[model samples]
Target: MRYWLYKSEPATWSWDQQKEKGAAGEEWTGVRNYQARNFMREMSVGDRGFFYHSNEGKEIVGIVEVVKEAHPDSTADDAKWECVDIKAVMDVPKPVSLEQVKAEPKLKDMVLVNNSRLSVQPVTEAEFAYVCELAGVDPEKAMKG
Candidate 1:
């Protein structure tokens, strides 16, 4: 399955709040950027994502599973906008800070390091695996459906 990184400000949507949503998950909405919207459209059910707490924590705090494919965002006025539903899978054993990612030689080419402002971004499998390793979460177990 494909992997992705989704960013949210802790003040707006914290990892704890996401976990509270339970299996029904919640629609990832309010993404106005075309690139970010496109990334959401590309997401499929069962895909994995890094739930990055931006602004406040600036770290990958947990894992989320795409439980629903992209659809018209309920929070939007325009039909062009779309979003996906994601459920919190588990918390990272150790949160991986942005500084830690930038300092890792193996993650030199990560999109997160290269483009810190993108709210939704694609992540390579290798990058995903390495992040899980750094977070002390088993990638194999995390990626399982």
Candidate 2:
């Protein structure tokens, strides 16, 4: 499965709120950016992503799994907008802060490091794995749930 990252302002949507959604998950709506919307369209059920707290924490606090594929965004009136449903999979034992990511030589090419403005962006397998390692999580075990 592909890896991705989803950023949300903590005051608007925190990691705790996402975990409360349970297995049924919640629609990742309100995205208006065409590039971000397109990234969601490329996602599939079972794909994993980093649940990042933007603005406030500026960190990767947990992991999430795509429970539903791309579908019409319920919060939007435009037919061109779409999103996926994702559920919290596991918490990062040690939150990986943006500063940590930027400092890491191995993660210099990460989208989160280079294009911090994108709310939804793709994550390469290597980048995903390294971040998981940095967060003190076992990538294999975290994905099993």
Candidate 3:
């Protein structure tokens, strides 16, 4: 499966709120950027994503699984965007801050490092594993859990 990084302003949609949704998952809506919407459209069920807290924490706080593929975004007024259902998989043992990510030489090519404004972005499998490692999370275990 593909990997992705999904950002949210914690003030708007925090990791706690996602966990609260549990197995049912929550609609990842309100994405207005065409590039971000396209990324959502490419997602498949079971794909994993890093749940990043953008404004407040500016860190990768947890993991989420795409339980439902892209569908019409109910929060959108027009039919130009789509969303997916994602459930919290697990919390990062040690949240990886943006500062840390920027500092990590291995993450130099990461989209989050190069284009921090992109709300929904793709992550390489190697980058994903590295971030999980830095966060004290076992990548495989986190995915399975």
Candidate 4:
């Protein structure tokens, strides 16, 4: 399965809130950037993603699974953008901070290192595994509120 990273502003939608939404998940909307929209369109069911808490925490706080494929964003008037449904899979015991990721030698070549501005980006299997290791949790564990 492919891996990816998706950032969310904590004040707007925190990890806790998403977990409360349960397995039904929520539409990944409001992605205005062309690059982010492209990534959304590429996502598929069962793909995993890093649930990043931007702004407040600025860290990779959890893991998510794409429950549905890309569809035209409902919030949009046109079909130019897309979104997917993602369920919370895991929560890092101690969030892997942006600073921590940058300091780790293993993550130097990771996309988050080279593209901090990307709201949504792809992640390699190796990088995903390393993050799970740092979080001290099994990558497959389901996250609950």
Candidate 5:
């Protein structure tokens, strides 16, 4: 099971919106950057990603799971890009803000650090576990309601 990070602004579509979407999930679309686009194409059903809140809070708020494979991106016609389905898994008890993440030396190499604008990025298992610990949430508690 691979892990990834997906970003969204709070006003447009926040963690709450995803949680409210319930089990059905919603397409993760509107990604325009080529790098972000590539990440979206690589995502598969059953893959998990961090539901990160960018622009507004700039923090890692919760986790999400991909429920469907890649498909056309709604933002663009002609299939210039694609999107995938991701549903809210669970919120971190304590949000790991960009500030907090940057403060930790152990997380210095995180994609959220190296690539600030990358909407979709990979996360190592060690980084994931460390984040769970920092947020005071069990990794197992992240996948279900």
Candidate 6:
């Protein structure tokens, strides 16, 4: 499974709000960027993502699993836009802040560090594993949960 990252403002969609959606998950809609939408199209069910709180906490607070593949975004008026459904998997034991990520040599090449504006972006397996390690989570076990 591929790894990804999803960013959201805490006031708009916090980690707690995502967890409240439960197993049914929630459509990751309202993404207007073509590149971000394309990334959603590439996702498949069971792919894991880091739920990062942007603007406020600026931290990887939790994990999410894609429950549905790309589909017409319910919130979008244009047919060109699409999104995936993701459910909360588990919380990051130790929230990994953006500052911490940037300071870590291993994550220096991460897309998040380079392109912080992208709402949805790809994450390398090595970066994902290392971040999980920093967050005190086992990547393998987190996926199983």
lDDT of each candidate versus the true structure:
0.95, 0.94, 0.94, 0.85, 0.85, 0.94
Best by lDDT: 1
Better of 4 and 5 by lDDT: 4
User: What is candidate 4's lDDT per residue for 5-116, written digit by digit as tens?
Assistant: 9999998888998898788998888888899888888888888888998878789888898998899888988788888888887677878988999999999988889988
Number of colliding residue pairs in each model: 0, 0, 0, 0, 0, 0
- List the pairs of residues colliding in candidate 3: none
What clash pairs does model 6 have? none
Candidate 3 lDDT, 1-145, residue by residue in tens: 8899999999899999999999999999999999999999999999999999998989999999999999999998899889999999999889999999999999999999999999999999999989999999987876552
- lDDT by residue (tens digit), candidate 6, 1-145: 8999999999999999999999999999899999999999999899999999999999999999999999999998889999999999999999999999999999999999999999999999889999999999997787553
Clashes of 3: 0
Off by over 4 Å in 1: none
Off by over 4 Å in 3: none
lDDT of 1 at 99: 99
Best by TM-score: 1
Clashing pairs in 5: none
Please say which candidate is ahead in lDDT: 1 or 5.
1
lDDT of candidate 5 over 1-145, digit per residue (tens): 7788999999999999999999899988888788887877787777777888999999889888989878898778668888888988888888999998899999999999989888888888778878878888887666332
Whose TM-score is higher: candidate 1's or candidate 3's? Answer: 1
lDDT of 5: 0.85
